[model samples]
Target: MKWVRSKICGITRIEDGLCAAHMGADAIGLVFYEKSPRYVGLDQARSIVQAMPAFVSIVGLFVNAQAAQIKQTFDYVGLDLIQYHGDETASFCEALALPYIRALRMQPDVDIAQVAKTYVNARGILLDSYVPGLPGGTGEVFNWSLIPSLDKPLILAGGLSSTNIAQAVAQVQPWAVDVSGGVEQAKGIKSAEKITDFMQALRANR
Candidate 1:
């Protein structure tokens, strides 16, 4: 069995970021959206990134941000990847000239395959649960059966935790899995124990 890559998102503190990296997480996300409680300031984000060991990817999460904002953050933090969690067009994403992952909120009517095709240049397509008037961190689980097999890598997100991750991996077999609120001690604060358990469960499944 292949190892299921893991990214611990919504990191707001340097301690949490280092904890995730120490626990073997492939990536740690820094939220740049002001509305999100997990949002990190540019200075904080840079500090967290600087604290990380080599080989740990630093991902910047944005929600409906302008190009200038993204560019400003990128120039400062030097994120390994960008995760767009808004209505960004493929051209808009491509214009940044940086590797990015498009987040697709799964509503019943959503055509994921078509969305994936439209963002063909994306490094991966992140499938997250949809909630009315919310961008992400909803902690709601969607129907995994809605996912279709495609050549592009699938990153399963939304409502993932140590309790359900094994079942989720067994069902979806995604290229990667992203978790935020699920392993959190509070909004934006991660628990090292939770992260360790989550990784243990994933390894057990493999």
Candidate 2:
């Protein structure tokens, strides 16, 4: 099957959320960690999720947050999925009993297939660049060639732009693709033009 998926993370405003949905995003990620520049408060996250059109999934992103904190955010925003970017254990992730995606920091010499197997119950695997001091949205791409035969759904991320997404799709053929800094006017701010361009490019590839 043809792989076609897109994610817009770090939404700070309702309009940005709307743009992502209107532009045909499969998922919209909301950051709950205060340390993240793109973090949105409970109220802001709720409003944004509510404003989003139907069929667009709401994904809550956390970086090394506790279960209590994750539950609190979920209760407030009612996210459909969880994206764990930090060193969250399998027990911690399964405790939520909700669908989730685990982010893998792609590094040279790492056994990519073996790493994915550890999160066997995950809804999908998110492959991102291993940038020091950056949780995600670093606008960096790992070598696409390093994907070592995936069995579960794979969501390709990091440094993807409209210009190169087709190349990414052609090569990795992931179940989905995610972009944040690549489609932003600035950190936490999305660009309508960029969103449209990205979607158009995505369609062109298909």
Candidate 3:
């Protein structure tokens, strides 16, 4: 619980990216998925990445995108990690030069352990809530009790905010926690005060 890292996902602006990094976020995520409201285009994402200080990772979220496109974006944005939110296969995930984390929408039949084994090359495994048609950013919490002991590092997401983050950390004790809408002023905009509060609450966990 004490060492849990935090990642502020769905960053669309350079100021938000800098705010998250300066406020002690371990990482800042950039959404490349066009369907997502928080989506950042190649030029915008590049600008954000360029302005970010070192030690704060930049993660690019892709939803079943083409291999070439992923490669191009990965190179163009100089992303530190690739987050796969759709139905990408293990080989497909590992084929890239950069490391990645596979985000699983916690559906009924999902076997977290099996997935951990299958995506052996993944740097970490992220668990998010399930919606009927969405790949990620569902903003709904799943039954954490259902998560079993696993081999890989777990990154918990879905509906995490300043209010319940401490409890979620105490319960799951994940390697890292990712939040999007939780610290937002709007769909694609971030609230610095909310981000600070969320990080402070997370740090207060013991």
**Per-model TM values vs. the true structure:** 0.98, 0.96, 0.97
Which prediction has the highest TM-score against the true structure?
A: 1
Error of 3 at 121 (Å): 0.8
Model 1 agreement with the true structure over 1-206: per-residue lDDT tens digits: 77899999999988898888988899999999999999899998999999999999989999989999998898899798999999999889998888899998997777788877888689999999999899999999999988887668999999999999999999999999999998899999999899899988988987
Full-model lDDT for every candidate: 0.92, 0.88, 0.91
What is candidate 1's CA lDDT for residue 154? 94
lDDT of 3 by residue, 71-92 (tens): 9999998999999999998988
* lDDT top scorer: 1
* Preferred candidate (lDDT higher): 1 or 3: 1
For every candidate structure, what is the RMSD over all alpha carbons to the true structure, in angstroms? 0.8, 1.2, 1.0
Residue-level error in angstroms, candidate 2, position 146? 0.5
Clashing pairs in 2: none
- lDDT for predicted candidate 2 compared with the true structure: 0.88
Candidate 2 lDDT tens digits, 1-206: 48498888889999998998988888999998798889999999999998988899999999999888888788889899999998887787887777889998897778978877877689999999998888787788889887878778999999998989989999999899988888889888999999899988998887
